[model samples]
Target: MNTRMNSTASEAAHQFIVIEGPIGVGKTSLARRLCASLSAQGVLEEGAQNPFLERFYRNQRAAALPTQLYFLLQRAQQLAALQQQDLFAPLRVADYLLEKDRLFAQVTLDQAEYRLYEQVCAKLDIHPPKPDLVVYLQAPVDVLLERIAKRGVDYEQRIERAYLERLNEAYARFFHEFEAAPLLIVNAASIDPINNHADYEELLAAIRRMKRGRLYYNPLRSRGI
Candidate 1:
């Protein structure tokens, strides 16, 4: 049975949703799962398409400018295309928030490079559609490292602990002050929602019921999983 079908109103509450988190925290995986469950269109980031990404990962100082610029332009173009679609279109689930690009710029680039990046961003003038709900996933640095290693991406394996720590802190700081949409802060350290049906269902239900304000979801392993 499709448990989601049981709550028609809840399903309709959120038409456009975004899943955001630090690298290796599984936002993309969760976004795909949510799209499958909700039968929504997905506007996901194509991180692999950036040619300079692996180089940036290997040596941040050398390739940070080009890497960040490429991502910024790619993300802006994606959002622009999405905006051109029908206004009354069906549900859409995205794995990233466009503003998060600036977060990366802040973390990876030095003063002059960031200034140039900001100038380009200002000129591009992208205004993404506001999501109905934003799901922010959180986990410890060790948990992030474990998940990254488990995935076994070649370039991702080279990610340093210090880099992840800085990125993780940037995410925390960004979400702490974020208030543009209804926010859901999820402690994703323990539950394996991608593989566990019960965990996914509970989280999905919570996502459906969300309509306004900020909510925190911290599920325990002792919840009979």
Candidate 2:
């Protein structure tokens, strides 16, 4: 945690916040910043630690199963560890949700591979903590592509546009029916919360104010011209 990023704790309404979105939508970056601002513990996934990730980017069909499985196991372990920690600790923020693992498996794996993945899931019997608030980010495919390019991860740059399209659709459907927690959907394409101080502060204010129900954070609509 960079000392420069730290601030007096915002006293967020939610003790546990999960930041979710399609790849390149800046979930991880926002999660880290939120952790700093809220003085929260971060339960971030180690996506780079997955050995099969680069290969999966290059050849989705060939490496999808192993890649998904590795992520599943890794994320499950991280959440399980979180579960074991003291329940009354400070606010906790995470970059990914356990349910998204199955979402990815559905999008990436073939029919035959999916059956095996399901069996593996059944065997693991994961039980992730329910988040008090979920902040879902949304952006256009073009924005996603541009952001991904700007990040300049060698393997990530190999990602296909078609795959990203499917992922965006999958995320849309998942969040549409999501009812496990209070949902706050932000139009990430309209706000650069990561680099812009005003934008981050405004969004952080919205986060601390949320209690229940689904809310959309569209600066354009909120501004009312």
Off by over 4 Å in 1: 1-7, 223-225
Q: Kindly list the per-residue Cα lDDT of model 1 for residues 136-193, writing each as its tens digit.
A: 9999999999999999989999999999999999999999899999999999997778
Each prediction's Cα lDDT score? 0.91, 0.90
| lDDT (tens digit, per residue) of candidate 2 on 42-149 | 999888899999999989899999999999999878888988886466679999999999999999999999999999999999988889999999998999999999
Q: TM-score for every candidate vs. truth?
A: 0.94, 0.92
- Which pairs clash in the backbone of model 2? none
Q: Model 2 — TM-score against the truth? A: 0.92
